[model samples]
Target: MTEETRRKAALVGAFERGAATYEQLGVDFFGPPGVELVHRAGVRSGQRVLDVGCGRGAVLVPAARAVGATGRVVGIDLAPTMVELTRAEVRAAGLSQVQVELGDAESPALPPGEFDVVLGGFVVFLLSDPAAALRGYRRLLCPDGRIGMTTFASQDPRFTEAMQMLVGYLPADRRRSPTSEHDALFATAESTAVLLRETGYRDVHVTDAAFESRFRDVEHWSAWIWSHGARSLLEQIPARRLPEALAEVTPVVERARAVAGDLVFTTTVRFAVAVSPG
Candidate 1:
């Protein structure tokens, strides 16, 4: 398989493993940029919308609501589990206009010109061929339609430290943190804007927002880590050294919660939006 395809597959695997815990800890608990991104993309009533890398309807569900009964909202994700989870949520919420399909966010092959707003949540950087995918999204938008997506500007400081601590303990070959792979994607809003413009988007704009993710204490913090995709780090721990690793990581957690009675993990998120020249 091609290297880019393999990277996409690994990303799908990571999300599949974390699908069940994603909404609560990863989206709501950690603050997914769905609602914010939807608004930025101008998802108005009666509009047809597509959410790339929908991830349990973080953006899809809200966009469905924004579009109301007259509009349609479709979501695509690489993981079957995420697709099924989003479908279930849509059913439970009685949102008949919302549909979730299993597809590669990197190259969603959905029909073109059907959507007025194409939104993505935490999708751009993870894409195997982001520029190609942006062009694909451009083709999917109706004339005058716009596209928007969120990428991480930075992760919480404590979370980064605890993550580094875990990676620091692992063998050299296994020392990479999951998020380290996409650090350059949203490093600067100007860079993100340049990408949109280069991909044939006009009136491109980038905005930033800070979101706080909180944990009651270390117990809650550890649970959140293990329950999410970050558990990949925990899984890498040598079975023999697991206990030692946990013990060593405790101080890092303790220091993180030192000042705040509740540990607040704050991250800066960047949203890039632009219009299809049509």
Candidate 2:
């Protein structure tokens, strides 16, 4: 398989393995950012929305609500489990206007110019070819349609240190985490905005916001990490070294403990919105 295909497959498999617990953990990690993405995209009633990498309906549900009954929302993800679970949630919520499907976020096989807005929440940097994906998303939009994506502007220092600490337990060949691998693409607001402009989008706007996620303690933090993409790194650490890894990461995270005893991390998320050229 081609390298990009291999990367996509690996991402699907990793997320499939964690789908059962993905975003199910009691943390406000994805929700706040997801909602903010929809709002920033200026989604409105009767508009069509496509949520790429719509994990657990985080962005899907809110976009659905924003569009209301007259509008339609389609959510696509590479992981079948993510699609299946998100569909179940959509059904449970009676969001008939929303549909979740198993499809690629990088290049969805849908007709061009069929959507009013496309939102990628914390999923752009994970793509094998983010620029290509952005260009494809622009093709999926109608003239003047907007696309909004969220990427990490900055992660908490404690969270960064703890992740690095965990990497020490990984085999030498696997020591680098995925976060480090994709950091450059969305490293700065200007860089990300330039990417959008280069990808044939116009009126690009990039903004940053801080969201606070809390964990009861180190154990809670562990569960939270395992439920999302961060699990990729944790999965690489040999099973025998899991305890050693966690033991070392705990103190680094504890350094962020709030006065009330909950471990708090303030993640700075960059939201970029741009309009499709006619």
Candidate 3:
């Protein structure tokens, strides 16, 4: 496999192992924002929708509900475990309009010109070939179909502070080559817009929103890290250095809580919506 493919495999495997905790954590981190974004997209009854990287069906379920009984929602993800979790949720929720499948966003296993709306949350940055993925999504849409995507606007200051401390404690090489840093992909809005334009999407709109979350204590931050795949960055480090890294991050977390007051951490998220011209 190519290096990019291998990295994606590792990333998907890590998320699969963390799926249960991810679902639990996602209820707070991703659920509400996803709903709000879809609502903003103004889905109507009988509009066909596709949810790319529909992890645990957070976005898909709501889209299905919005579309009513006449419409359909198809969710695609790279991880089999994610697909299973999404399917189980759909069954339990009794949402017949929603279905889940295992597939890559770069080359979704979907027929062209099928969907009226295509949406996903926090998935754009995760794609290895985001431009190619967007081009593929464009093909899957009907004439004048719209796409909505959500991603981090900038690293949350609190999260970045904690990460900086942890990296400081790691060996120099590991710190410099950290897996969690995707410097090339999500660094700026201009770059993201350029990518979307290059992929053939037009009338792109981007907006930023902030949310505040509270972690009871440092342990909560630690748990969040493990549950959100940040722990994978520590996997290659020597076991002896793990404690030191965690220790370094603890003070940063504590400082953030103090600055936040009531232990609330703030994150800034950006959403982009674009339409494919007929």
The reply for model 1, stretches above 4 Å from the true place, is 25-32, 177-182, 258-260
Per-residue CA lDDT of candidate 2, range 1-278, in tens? 98557656766788888898887888898899999999999999999999999989888999999999999999999889999999998999999999999988879999999999999998989987788999888889999999999998889999989888887877897766554556676889988988999999999999999999998999989988888887778887889989888988888889989887789999999999999995
Estimated TM-score for each candidate = 0.91, 0.96, 0.90
| lDDT top scorer | 2
Off by over 4 Å in 3: 169-185, 258-262
For each candidate, the alpha-carbon lDDT, in order, equals 0.79, 0.89, 0.77
Best by TM-score: 2
The C-alpha stretches of model 2 lying farther than 4 A from their native spots are 2-4, 179-182
TM-score of candidate 3 relative to the true fold: 0.90
TM-score of 2: 0.96
| Clashing residue pairs found in predicted model 3 | none
lDDT of 1 by residue, 1-278 (tens): 98556655666787788788776653254345777888888889999998888887778988998999999998998889889988998999899999899887777788878889888888778776688989988888889889988887777777777788778777887676554555565568988988899889999989899987767777777767766567666766787987777777777777656374777777888889999976
RMSD of each: 2.2, 1.3, 2.5
What's the best-to-worst order under lDDT?
2, 1, 3
